[model samples]
Target: MQIEPFTLHVPQTQIDDLHRRIDMTRWAEQETVDDWSQGTPLAALRELVRYWREEYDWRRCEAWLNATGQFTARIDGLSIHFLHVRSRHENATPLVLTHGWPGSILEFRNCIAALTDPEAHGGTAEDAFHVVIPALPGFGFSGKPTQAGWGVERIGRAWGELMRGLGYARWFAQGGDWGSAVTTAIALQKVEGCAGIHLNMPIARPQPEDLAAPSPTEVRALTALQHYQDWDSGYSKQQQTRPQTVGYGLVDSPVGQAGWIYEKMWAWTDNAGRAEDALDRDAILDNIMLYWLPAAGASSARLYWESFGSFAAKDIDLPVAVSAFPKEILPTPRKWAERHYRKLVHWGDMEKGGHFAAWEQPEAFVRELRIAFGKMR
Candidate 1:
């Protein structure tokens, strides 16, 4: 594995072009219902885009990426971008953190310091981790797959190779969203160096009997699943089936790209009416910028096309930990998770947070990982 330092510096012209696109966007009529039923509301989107063009600072984000130890390595002939932040504390555990859709490595930015330097972040040095945060192929600066076959299983193997290449003989993994699927793949592959895995979004399906004799937790989980299948899964369906078709707009229009992602920020976060309740306005745009600047709209979406149905229950015998946020897309019950993760080590039902756990509540996310991985260690 040949690795090299990578720095991010989006050209000023590109920033200007993004602003130009926002200015030229053809406005859509306000939704008939005043709610987010039709899509990202026109007034709300206008306000966000106005701030994005007039006030947001892309250079701050660029500087952070560069200072954060950005690096790239070619794995299986595809360039993979990652942040490698090693803890100065001796014997710090090697931990690879992966992010999912609508999330880039940026999702874990605020967590890096607390994770790699726990002593300074209200924890003993014993909780320290040497963090490796990788952008999934085609999602950030990572090279897009020129052909098919870059699904969860393949990505899992790549992560294993990446860890070994970084000289980590024993490491733990943590993830949510697509990251969870990839982490599960790593555990299932029995990757030699992988010590244990933690998932925020544990994908354990309900059995016939479990549904027939439902517990309160089971009922809530099943209800959320139904809601996802009914109203909230349109993006998944579009990406899974016709990524290229939708990419035209997402790639061409910055507003289109922002709205596509903003809706998820609103729907998935533990917010009170608006996404801004849970997330910073600029942080949201910073994430969207990753997709827009790299023009990764279609390439990133192709991950769904590649691994849509791969979120099934797995009989993983490796030590596992799970944090079930109350607002998670489908907060699987511990009983169901235990059925899949035979050696379940930790199960936490969080009081707050949603799909993007780390981004929504970095402190809680960090605490969960500290406690969960501590059990494995």
Candidate 2:
């Protein structure tokens, strides 16, 4: 497994082509509703597209990623891309942070400097971590899986190998969204040298017994889950059922791709009312570029088709820590989480943050990881 250092450099032709496509976008009719009831509002998206074409600098994002250490390794017959930032603290615990669908390593970029050098970011050396942020197979710079079975379980196994390959005898895992599912899979598999795992969006589901006599939190959680299934799950359903069909538009039209993910950024983040409220435009664009530059729309969504139903957390006896973000698509209540995570070591209900916890709330996100892993460390 040869690991090679990587850098970011999108071909000029590709950038030119993106600009041309954005310019030639044949827009659809605007929604009748006053708000985001339908999807990304046309006016909002038009402004974003304008900025994306005229002002948003992909080169800056590229340079930022290049400055951060990056590498690609052949793992499980696939070329996996990851950002490996070692902490100055020699004894820092190794940690593998994974990103989910509609997300990439960009989600963790802001937290890297803080995590790897805690003292530099207002924390002690004890809080430092040697962080490894992997672009999930079929996302960002990672090679797309040509065959099936590159789901959460397989990704989890690959992450174990990745940690070992990087010379870490022991490590911890942290993630949210699809990342949470992958982390849970790692815990369930009892990956060697995995000290523990931390999750922002835990995959605990209300069991039949719990639904019979639900607690107040469980009732609220269940209601939210139902709402998600009814409304917000269209993207999941489309991806699970016909990723190839959706891929055509997303891969071809930059606007189509942006709209698909932009809506989620709005719906998922704790942005109060708009995505820009919580996350800056550049951060959001940086994330979108991960998909746009790589044309990973279909490949990223295929994980849903492969492992959506299989992601639920089961009874795992390993030490597990969970941080439940309030505005998450479906926040897992502590009581519900306890039912699945047998040795629930840490449970936190954060005041703010949502699906993109690391991106939306880096300070709180870093603090949670430090606190959660401190117990195991």
Candidate 3:
């Protein structure tokens, strides 16, 4: 349970090497269709790669991570890297935020200021939080698990220990994507200090009854879920089935890694056909850098291999809150969520945002957390 300071300092040589790899990429032929029906467009990827090689400054991102207060603590034989930003408000709640696949701790950068200093970010002092954003094992600067069994359930247990080690007797938890699975696992385990939990991508699959008698929203949700299964979940299938096979290319080529993630950025984000519409080029590159810098293409994918099926419904008695972003992978209804989360507290059908709720919409994300956790407190 010992905590130690961690600083991000990517060596100059390593950065230079990344530039070389991007320069030497052997790009494939462009997609047949003009749109993104096939995969990442060669033209778009090349444009992104051009910027990454020529102008994107890794050092700038490195400095921000350092200044944001990074730390490492050993738990379950792995050193977990996290950003611990404590609010000045004495009564601020301690909250643990988790990131999922194709994402890193960088996802929460914009959210830190608003959560840690609510007054400065259009909120009263009472809305403040002592935020802890942890990089999931095998992602970012966190130590990769050499052995197996480091899935969501184990991760949930480790988070409990992490908060306890940090001297947080009472706290709230929030997550999206795979993070939603972990936070739900924590609730199922009934982690002692966790007061309540919040989720942006609440994983509640539709039952027979739901399908038989569906509302307009439920019908739309069902259609979206079908679309994901039919078209969008190819990445998940590959990662969960053969992460190592995909890892070889991702780990070797910078463009390969970028293309792998860039596709999701385009598909998942709430944009008008381009990821750039929702997230800036620099921001997208910042996220891709985490995987590239760590060479975590394979290791990060292992979480899917280990816990792909764990996103199923579970009876969780702990107080739960959900924010169903419009373009989330599967925006299930409140009635569906209430089936699994017995003591549901808050349900927000957010007008905007997508799968990466916090990253895509930090203001809305912060507002959800403040309102959701505010109820429990």
Runs off by more than 4 Å, candidate 2: none
For each candidate, the alpha-carbon lDDT, in order, equals: 0.94, 0.90, 0.92
In candidate 3, how many Å is residue 235 off? 0.6
2 versus 3: better lDDT goes to: 3
The root-mean-square deviation over C-alpha atoms between each candidate and the true structure, in angstroms, is: 0.8, 1.1, 0.8
lDDT digits (tens) for residues 53-94 of candidate 1: 899999999998999899999999999999999999869999
State every prediction's TM-score relative to the real structure: 0.99, 0.98, 0.99
Clashes per candidate, residues 3 or more apart or on different chains: 0, 0, 0
User: Residue 289: error of model 3 in Å?
Assistant: 0.8
Q: Point out the worst 10-residue segment of candidate 1 by lDDT.
A: 330-339
Q: Output the better candidate (1/2) by lDDT.
A: 1
Please give, for residues 1-377, the per-residue lDDT of candidate 3 as tens digits.
89999987988999899988887878798888998879899999999999999888888888998998999999999999999999999889999999988888878889999999999999999999999989999998899999999999999999999999999999999999989999999999998799999999998888888889999989999999999999899999999999999999999999999999999999999999889988888989999989988899999999999999998989999899999999998778888888888888899988888889999999999999999999999
Order of models, best lDDT first: 1, 3, 2
Which residue pairs show backbone clashes in model 3? none
Q: What is the TM-score (0 to 1) of candidate 2?
A: 0.98
